[model samples]
Target chain A: MSTHARPRIGEQHCQECLVSIGPERIREEFPTLWTKVHGKPLVYLDNAATTQKPRSVIEALTRYYTEENSNVHRGVHLLSQVATQAYESGRTKVRQFVNAAHDREIIFTRGTTEGINLVAQTYGRRALRAGDEVLISAMEHHSNIVPWQMICEEKGAALKVIPMNDAGELLLEEYRRLLTDRTKLVAVTHVSNALGTVNPIQDVIALAHGRGIPVLVDGAQAVSHMPVDVRELDCDFYAFSGHKLFGPTGIGILYGKAYLLEAMPPYQGGGDMISAVTFEKTIYNTLPYKFEAGTPHIAGVIGLAAAIEYVERVGRNQIAAYEADLLAYGTEILTAVPGLRLIGTARDKAGVLSFVLDGIHAHDVGTILDLEGVAVRAGHHCAMPVMKRFGLPATARASLAFYNTRADLDALAKGLHKVREVFA
Target chain B: MSDLRELYQQVILDHYKRPRNFKKLDGATRQAEGNNPLCGDQITVYLHMDGDLIRDISFEGAGCAISQSAASLMTTVLKGKTKAEAGALFEKFHEMVTGGENAVDPMELGKLAVFCGVKEFPVRVKCASLPWHTMRAALEGQNGSVSTE
Candidate 1:
């Protein structure tokens, strides 16, 4: 078997001269997004949970399983080499996607949850001394909070919370006050998954940097909706999941600064992450390889790269603009319904509308909406603290993607009326 | 589908709207809180036990129509029955709502006949039985809140 030229992603699958995607193209490409639920055209507004995959991403996974099904970076055969190249290209794509300085900084994990746990167990456990504090926001998802709690608990370090105001925006003044000599690390979400508040991460990072404290930004909710530049933010660490970005589940990116990753211990000990294994003393692999233990999700990486490419082709600016319109439209229409109360009204928010109907539980609203083929999440949204902050049990949330339309919001509005009718 | 209709029948809605015995029992012999973590629904069952017979009962909580109404109906049926009878009723009701192969007759359930629609929705079975489970916990004297994970 001969080593061929560089990994090309099989050009026939993706034409190089492809046009940038718009909302129209998104509708046409995502056949599942337009599926009929209960004989009604599916109006999916649960994008925050997971974005629907484009045709390219699905095909990428299909092609990988069909042709390039082999272990990466080990075998001398052509298939293994091709798979390794594709996987490496995935890392490069992730690096560029987040504007990281180097591909070596990227580590693959299960998703946002595992990424946080990785940092918590490795960097957090190693760096934090007793009486030290790890500060997080009130609006953070449980994934962002629980891992820190677990690590802080084990390390005998305290977990401090940055409270938010009624609008669901983190109180920066309070955050400034919370900062002290003992504040070892600050973990904040780039955009709140529950409240949809886009945090002032740059300002947060600068403040932490002043105190000589490193910050970890949870970018799971923000990456799909906006452009992220780790170099621009100068954050020590950033993490995001692939499923939320229209790729397969069980794959995510954890992009840390190289120096920090070097100092931290490897997350897990397993194969592909070892330079040499010995009974007495085993040496870990360098940079990324050290962090990426075991056989990685080869197909997932390729699919994620495809998803990132699809996002790139769609033009982040175009997607952002379209989603903004949808958000405005959704807010206005959802607000018009009688007795409806919007939960999070932060000035800076992503494409999420969380609300409650008077005298009706969110679960009831969700059940009624499901009959009409409108999918919206009605629960604490894995952000129990956010729900607690608002003094609510749960809220009905409709989060948007570029593919979602004003008509979908209308379906939601119509469905809410049925909810009211049932109670009335 | 008519499943929604069956799940939210007028009787269930009426019970939800104006629940029977939905006041805090100030002097309760036993009590247990039931919480559905998924929906953030909470129900507390208060049993005033007099020997084997439940002399009086009341409840107070907030939840979906199915859960609240089921709790209300539970409080009503459990008033005159002995502890053993309530336990039997709970078992029969559980089987009816979960659509067990040993399903009870709808006529046997009476007002609970409306809950026959709940059998179709496996997820909501917890909603319908949260109060019954809480009452069982209250009787058995569990330490803390009962959660339907």
Candidate 2:
């Protein structure tokens, strides 16, 4: 096991504390944001889908291939050792990023989907029995819902849902009622990708803990928006994708508690997971390496560490404050549009502004918005149940990041006006 | 906004707002449902056949302006055509929207020519072609539904 790390520099000495970083400076960091679409300046509002990578992160990926390109954890050569230290440094960064208990608790996987699937197949398959239930909220992304369903079906266990209100906020009362003795696990999202509702996961964990049930948080949408202390949340398993955090794709972290990960079996069989291999028998490796099989995404891990460093330098609190204001301004501008109804109106929300305009399909709105060089997501958003709850097939979602300015929102409003004009 | 104007022509917008035959057919001889899961678009084509000819054609579904308008225009043109004629027309329409080589003349398509703009927007080709696929399925006695994955 390696050392559990802290942020590279203390928060008090951070540059954001001394001087406020405006959106203009932040925008310059992301090269893609400067490009034009359809002969118009791009207004990227699809942060929920995936964020634009900063120059630092892009450079990090390129640097790894150009400078230190070697397989990790196996080589005794100098280049291999350098690459191994960098890869392990990435793990330590992720450990500190989520504020997990140990470096070994952070297992790098493909993305959030794989992270949840790991827990579902290993922990869920082990704990669940013939009559057991795996409780999840209605607002969960398909990644969180499907894995448990697969495990439940195989184990002859039932999959249950905790209902939510029209506001897109989960019903704590219903959740309490549903948390029965037979529920083996509780999985929920920290922030809804489609709805943007910031669930009270602290209280959710407490409620589940009251009944001695462990909670797993789908933090894919939360990690970039706000400060996520897995220790503070007391969640047993926390999963998130690096791409959504402005990192490289195909890399993500699953931070499981030391005890829980130690008890759970390896999800996949291959090279790194085993301590010794023979025809007769084999012993599994330590905590995280036990779960990580095959050649891991070393470059992705290095890129993810660079992304973490970039975000930390920008300051999480500043990002949260900036985006909160953007969300409020966006809500005000969109609500004023006639025949437009906001889908997720949770009092506590983050990043997303999902809506539907009357007499215009979401695809049409997305098309019109694209014509104006404003990018957004217009589909089920992989949250079909949430769409059904709102009685909509799809919604046009404009998700915000710290780099977005009020001018971007103005462009969105202008594009929406164009949609109305065209449809009218 | 020249491209936008060509894509969302007044005819398409009008049909989208007040689609013709946007209801379930009562005495339809054959029907098939089509779904574009990417955009959550669903369409059901209902055909009333009289021996070899399609006596009536209708569609009931919800989708983008291109899809709904394309279906509405399809119902109007194929009213009394034979299944073979409709199939040929569908092929021409498909070629027009996909910008195929040796594309059918726009004048030959008449009101259906409005969908020519769909060629510029490749992602929406499925939307324009979904109802036609469903209509083909209905004519061929395909059971259950079709998905434009």
Q: What's the TM-score of every candidate structure?
A: 0.95, 0.97
For model 1, the docking class works out as medium
Residue pairs with backbone overlap in model 1 = none
Model 2's CAPRI class is high
Tens digit of per-residue lDDT, candidate 2, span B1-149: 99999999999898888888878888999999999998889999999999989998889998788888989999989999999999999999999999999778988888899998999999999999999999999999999999999
lDDT of 1 at A320: 74
In Å, residue A256's CA in model 1 sits off its true spot by: 0.4
lDDT of 2: 0.92
DockQ score of the complex predicted as candidate 2: 0.88
Candidate 2 residues A1-424, lDDT tens each?
1122433222334665412655776777799999999999899999999999987788888888998999988999988999999999999999998898799999999999999999999999889999999999999999999999899999999999999999999999999999999988999999999999999999999999999999999999999999999999999999999999999999999999999999999999999899998999999999889999999999999999989988888888878888888899999999999899999999999999999999899999999899999999999999998888888889999999888988999999989999999987
Tell me how far the alpha carbon of residue B66 in candidate 1 is from the true structure, in angstroms, after superposition.
1.4
TM-score for the first chain in candidate 2 comes to 0.96
Chain B TM-score of every predicted model = 0.96, 0.97
Summing lDDT over every window of 10 consecutive residues in candidate 2 chain B, give the lowest-scoring window: B17-26
